[model samples]
Target: MRHRLVTRGAVALCILVAVALIGYGLAQAMTTSHQQTVQGTSENSPHSGDGTKANPRRTRLEVGLDGCTKGWDDPGAGAQVFDIKNTSDRPMDVVLLGTGDKAADPHHDPRKAQIYAELEALGPGVTRSMTTSIEAGHFHFSCMPEDGPVVDGTDTNVPQPSAELASSLPSPVQHAAPATEQELIPYTQQYEEWVKGQLPDIASQADQLKDVIQRRGPNWREEAQSIWLTAHHRYMTLGGAYGAFGDLGDSIDGTAAGLPQGPNDPDFTGFHRIERGLWANESPDDLLPLAQGLSNDLSSLQDQDLAVGALEIGLRTHEVSEDIATQTLSGVDDFGSHSGVDSARAQTEATQKLVEILRPLLADRMPADHLTAIDQRLDAAQKRLDDASAAHPQTAPADLPVPERNAVRSQIGQLSEQLAEVAAVTDIRRAT
Candidate 1:
């Protein structure tokens, strides 16, 4: 009886262990199956319903442009991908802007609303995509007026879309908003008139330079150089009106980069040309034509119906410092004269003037303390230039020793950072 009882107990223990092992294997299999299902869904399935796929929701808008067509008749607000085609002969750039509050908030642009995205320099017959997220609101599309002449064997003109279709296009603001919210058209007109008033001073300076160049006396070069500096500063003062100048601006102050051969290129016209001639010790006669060309360009610009709209006026304030960093401090602008600091001084002073003009408008948006600090920074930068100038008489900033040059560069860099904030604060962007 004892042996039988032991045998039964062993069998029962074996049976119990077998059942436990079976249950554990079943559980493991079930878990593996579940994990496989999840992995399959994530890796194999298209448009996984759980919102795990990359760019799960993408909206596409087909855009077609030519000389005649302007914008999409129907625009939807959301995250959108714009596939734009340039059907025109010339290269094109496109901008889509929201009608957000056009106030002086760095985080916001009231008139332009908000910038969705921009596609720039699209070549003829080429297609490109621009993706941006936008809020539900009014929006408009603009193509930068094409640059240069139309390419041969390509259509320069396209039939205008039907009037019904044209009417569907969103209406752009006829004029830029004022610094104050008082009047839009009047404010823009007033600014335009002001731009007109300033042109004469530039012309007069150019005329003085022409006279100095014509004299060719014993000190003619010195007199002409000094007058050229004055004229250059005066022209820079018109930074507020840069946009309105358009091609004329290029004819007046365009750099050599645009030309194939750079500085030595025959196409290299404007103030810098004279600068090269003067600094290279070229004869006054050799430089006279360049000087005369500059004077003539100024006079022509004076007569042109140029205007500094509200958009450009605000932009000039920030671009001045930006130019300092990219051009002046980099010593690109002073390749001929080596007076990069002088150029910087003139640019900064003019930019300061622009800031002061816009201060009242800016005051409403920016903290007074921040504005004061910017002023102080500008002053400090100017003082550094002054000190360096005093220390190194008859020496260009480019010729300064490395240490002294670095010290000046550091101050200018600091000021540039602060100046950058002004654009952000104002929410200014160039018109496409």
Candidate 2:
């Protein structure tokens, strides 16, 4: 009996040893696998930035009343984003600054250039984010070499850029130089003609936007939204390229698609701020940063303002119209930051604010007959939006290729001219 028991005990001990060895081997394999997986993670991980987490990109950077961004509203608002392909042979740190003819300073109060985000040294082929918070303002983008700040003790009293220390900085973009003014001039002229064409159509586009909004059902909103977004993007881009909206979308796009399509933005309170500044009153605050981001050599931006004045022509149509209380616009400001949806939202919001300023001003100043005529136009605009809302977005995709968008661009151009008559602000009473 003792011998049998001893044999059994010996068998159990061997089995236990085998199981323990197998478990240990599996654990070791898993640990090694996990470490390797981590090691292979992308080089741009925030951790790769000196082992720190990446800061969430901001959409709004506010300094008192001043704001600036590449996007329509701000950075991440609706600026065209493309990856920086830095194949430049030079080894340098790239500094991003908002610039005009005037230089930028941290202490320099706005009404001049403003400094936003700075991305430091990025060796060739490495990528980094070009990011800043979104605010409804103007922004100019340019890159300076890392030494541009410190090379001659020029800005020495100013602190060195924090971007320099960022390990995750993206390589700065530097476009190849144009060898000839002849090559550049046609491109400039083409852009000029394209913009000049838009000033005539601002009113019609606004009317089209209203139709897209009201006549269509909830689903059709996206299609209508895209129409105005393209219009808004054009206006903002024109503003950047030229400086203000040259009275283009003044009539139809403003009050109709502006916020007449509200209840969409969730935050309903901000609407009051827009209404008070623009429509209800004419304090210089109506335009805020829009009014401020100006430089002494301001012809380009001023032309844009003229375009914007053209964009405001809709205020004439909506002025005698107290119908907005009855109209419903979705997500009036609900478009969240950085989402593609936000661009549409910002454009719509900007239009509403513009009208808010123009309507009250137009009503107070324009003749009764003119006000009545504008009201009739508003009635037509209301019907158009009603029809558009009833149509399906899928019926006509808003993202029709660039050619279609450009083709449609003509109508918006005609609309701008319609608004220009209203722009004769001989009616604008001095702000008491």
Candidate 3:
């Protein structure tokens, strides 16, 4: 009996040893599999924990303003983004700089840093963003508050750009040769003749409107107003010619805001005067002479050989868009008529015409992407204007729904930003 019990005990020990060996084997396999998985994950990761990568792209760089915080991360060039926030109670102008050795001293100031991008004139609590490509370099940020000390951050002494960053920088844009006098004269003359052709139609419509005002029939007032709006649209299309039009341009389209006498000023003439009269329900009898005078002025405009400066005309592609945003989109251009949307459309059409005329010159000169972006934004802005007009057929532009108004404002802002680059693309210049 003792011998049998001893043998059973040995068997039990063997079974126990077998169980321990199996468990150890399973654990070892699991550990090996886990280690393989971890190694694979590390190798496949796009960016390593050390911040090195192939074509490292960063999220938008946040800029804090209003004496709160001033800081930025070096995005290491390629296309970068900036989200500028104004936390203060006043306006702030934030600038993004790519500094060189010259910027180490504060006394050198603005000249030391090359301003790669800027968000100028942000109202209190406003936030705006800009997307631009930069060459890899030492970079920092500066914010100038309207009512506080300039807040600056990030180490000013940035290290030398990496070789990868330097390689990613875009080649310098090759500018188009400036249009010579011989080339400019014909284009300018053709554009001027185009302006002259539109004036006769403007004068003719003004005459018809004047006649309707004189008739004073029940429907004559409406007919007259319709003619006036039509005439106003035609005149707006000629905005590129305004620089050459001189004082006559003001007499024909000037607003009352800056004038000492205001809208009631006798000098506040042309389309706006007629608009005030029509909207205010002023006596049709009183508006007759104003319409006749507008017609006469328009007729005179056709006879004049208005010589425009080449640079002035070249700059109009950008300047027209700027004016539309500042004046028409703001609803100041047609305060009485509430036809600001129509005015914007007119300006856009004129600018597009100018684009077509200069397309050959612009082909390889400007960045194709910029031109394409301008077209897309302009189309979006036009759609927004159309939507506004359709949604509120009778509502004045100033009184449109906040959403619609915001849409218009946002689209116009983007469109203007793209348009602003046109002058530089065409090698356009200010007068010498």
Count of clashes in candidate 3: 0
In model 2, the worst 10-residue window by lDDT is: 24-33
lDDT of each: 0.55, 0.30, 0.58
| Residue 373 accuracy (lDDT) in model 2 | 53
Q: Pick by TM-score: which candidate is best?
A: 3
Candidates sorted by lDDT, best first: 3, 1, 2
Q: Which candidate's lDDT is highest?
A: 3
Off by over 4 Å in 1: 1-195, 428-432
Model 2 agreement with the true structure over 50-158: per-residue lDDT tens digits: 2122443322211100111122221222122323322332222332233323234455422233333333343334444443322223344333222222211012111
TM-score of 1: 0.56
Could you tell me the lDDT of residue 262 within candidate 1? 90
lDDT of 3 by residue, 342-372 (tens): 7777777777777766666555445576567
Worst 10 residues of 3 by lDDT: 24-33
True-structure RMSD for candidate 1: 24.7
Give the lowest summed-lDDT range of ten residues in model 1.
24-33
Candidate 2 residue-pair clash tally: 83
Model 2 alpha-carbon drift over 4 Å, by segment: 1-189, 201-243, 246-330, 333-391, 394-432
Give each model a TM-score. Answer: 0.56, 0.20, 0.59
